[model samples]
Target: MAKIKEKLGRWLRVAIGGPMGIIAWGISGASAMAIVVWGLQTVALPLLMLKTASWGIWGLGVFRESRAKRENPPPKV
Candidate 1:
């Protein structure tokens, strides 16, 4: 009788605890993912904008240089 009660208690604890543990684990994982995504967006967005602007400026410089060279060709060596 004592052994049966002990087994039943352990089974009840497992039945109650398993789903709760799973739920807690899922919430923690989702929270961690949200934090990581937020951090990446915060840090990456400005950097991406800066890089795009830099590329645009560089492209304009190249275009201007090409146009100038075409207008004033260097004397042939």
Candidate 2:
């Protein structure tokens, strides 16, 4: 269905865009901490791993919360 596809697209955009916006907007906290650690890491290996882990956690939380709100519409009679 077009509506379903649109909804999915919107969700994906949010998932991908959220972090980017956070970074662009200079939002801080855990993600900032991870980024600082990443930038300081001299070796590429652990940096990549931590980067993935941090983004994964961030994305998973945002996607889950977004999906829940999307899937559950308000009650109506």
State which candidate has the highest lDDT.
2
Q: Determine which window of 10 residues in candidate 2 has minimal summed lDDT.
A: 21-30
Instruction: Supply the global lDDT for candidate 2.
Output: 0.58
> Per-residue CA lDDT of candidate 2, range 1-77, in tens?
97779768767756654555355334325445665776655535655665676566566657765776679853553
Task: List pairs with backbone clashes in candidate 1.
Answer: none
Q: Mind giving the per-residue lDDT tens digits that candidate 1 earns over 16-62? A: 33444345445445545655777756646554555455445445545
Candidate No. with top TM-score: 1
lDDT of model 2 at residue 53? 66
Q: After superposing candidate 1, which stretches have Cα over 4 Å from the reference?
A: 1-42
lDDT of each: 0.53, 0.58
Give candidate 1's whole-model lDDT: 0.53
CA displacement after TM-score superposition, residue 23 of candidate 2 (Å):
15
| Error in Å for residue 75 of model 1 | 2.6
Model 2 reaches what TM-score against the true structure? 0.39
